[model samples]
Target: MRWARAIHHLEALAQECAVMATRPASIFPVRVVELWAVGDVLGPLRDIDAVTVALAVDLPVEEVPWLGQPRGAQQWANATRLDRNPIVGLWRSVHAPVWNHRVERPALVWDAENGVAEKTLAALHDGAGERVRLPAPGAEEWRARLTEELAVSVRALRDCTAAYEQRRWSPGKLEPVADALWRASEGYLDVLDALHGPPEPT
Candidate 1:
């Protein structure tokens, strides 16, 4: 009931209102759609990716990041463990090249004119909660589209939830509907999958 209620709540907010968002010169360069495909939220106050932190926040990868303590500083610290020591000079090589926990290269993906930066992530919203479960039109329609996609997805997942959780259906029993839901959410999930890279061998 809770999950169904949650889905219903999100579905209701599928229509969003727009607000002004300026394209700055070089921070938060990545758009919401890409971030969502990889599973992250949008907006200025939200945290960007770990790689974004290293570059935008100007934290050296070698430093003992604050570690995912609770706040941004702590999450930054968690990027480096016993592994990386990025080379400061060209022809780059680290004291321990493997120490790098950073994935994005700001130098490459940044659109300085627009203030967008590079990042790696999953397709989710940072502000995601019962209230934000519904999607709305944000800076780009992608968020709106994702909201719709999520709405449809939640409904689909609900079916499986019913059969698996409530109906107590077996594999074959839920196969048809499960396959349909998977097909529906596949496009959106692909976006998240891209940020993560290829799926592991099954």
Candidate 2:
């Protein structure tokens, strides 16, 4: 898959973030976990976006063998289960205001994130594919890399959204791509706020 490398990179980042969550002095433990969750969600999302782009450009659909299969449901289920994880639940309970402040439209964003994954996986049943083990970076390096990669993923999803819009695809087809873009953009914003702290109050 063209996005294989990016997906792997995200996984590596997520792993590092998980370790960061364990640090005694980490002030952004919840945010770190959120980043990890976002990375998990993005794996399948990137695959969906890639296939959507391929289809838009008139590429052979056969290259993706998982489309129109049931396996995607399982993949989506597995990826999203983390949202209900106890740690994430605790974050929601304890840090609701902080998260809301950092991410505008938190409910809508979360819905879009899950909705896109469900719809895309239902239609295009490809799992996250093979794992590419990457070495987790140190704190400073991982933070820098996460910012860079989040930007790249957001830009790619934006391009994918444009491809669908340009072709005048149906809402059914276009909605998922747009939702994916929205989710990715929110994830980027969340990360930025986590890294540098949220913007000062007006």
lDDT tens digits, residue span 1-202, model 2: 4455434433443344344435543332122223312223323435322111100111122211111111122232234343322222112221212122222212111121222223322222233322321234467765665465445445644664676577565544666555545655565566567667889999
Which portions of model 1 miss their true places by more than 4 Å? Answer: 1-139, 167-173, 184-188, 191-202
Q: Model 1, residue 192: what's the lDDT?
A: 38
* Pairs of colliding residues, candidate 2: none
* lDDT by residue (tens digit), candidate 1, 1-202: 1333322222221111001113331532221111111112222224333212122222222221111111132222232220132111111111212112122111211222332222211112223232322233244454443343344344545544564554345544765445444543553354334334657899
Distance (Å) between predicted and true CA of 121, model 1?
40
Residue 37, model 2: lDDT of 25
Best by TM-score: 2
| Model 2 misplaced stretches (Cα beyond 4 Å) | 1-138, 167-173
Could you estimate the TM-score for every candidate?
0.22, 0.31
- Per-candidate local distance difference test: 0.27, 0.34
Clashes of each: 24, 0
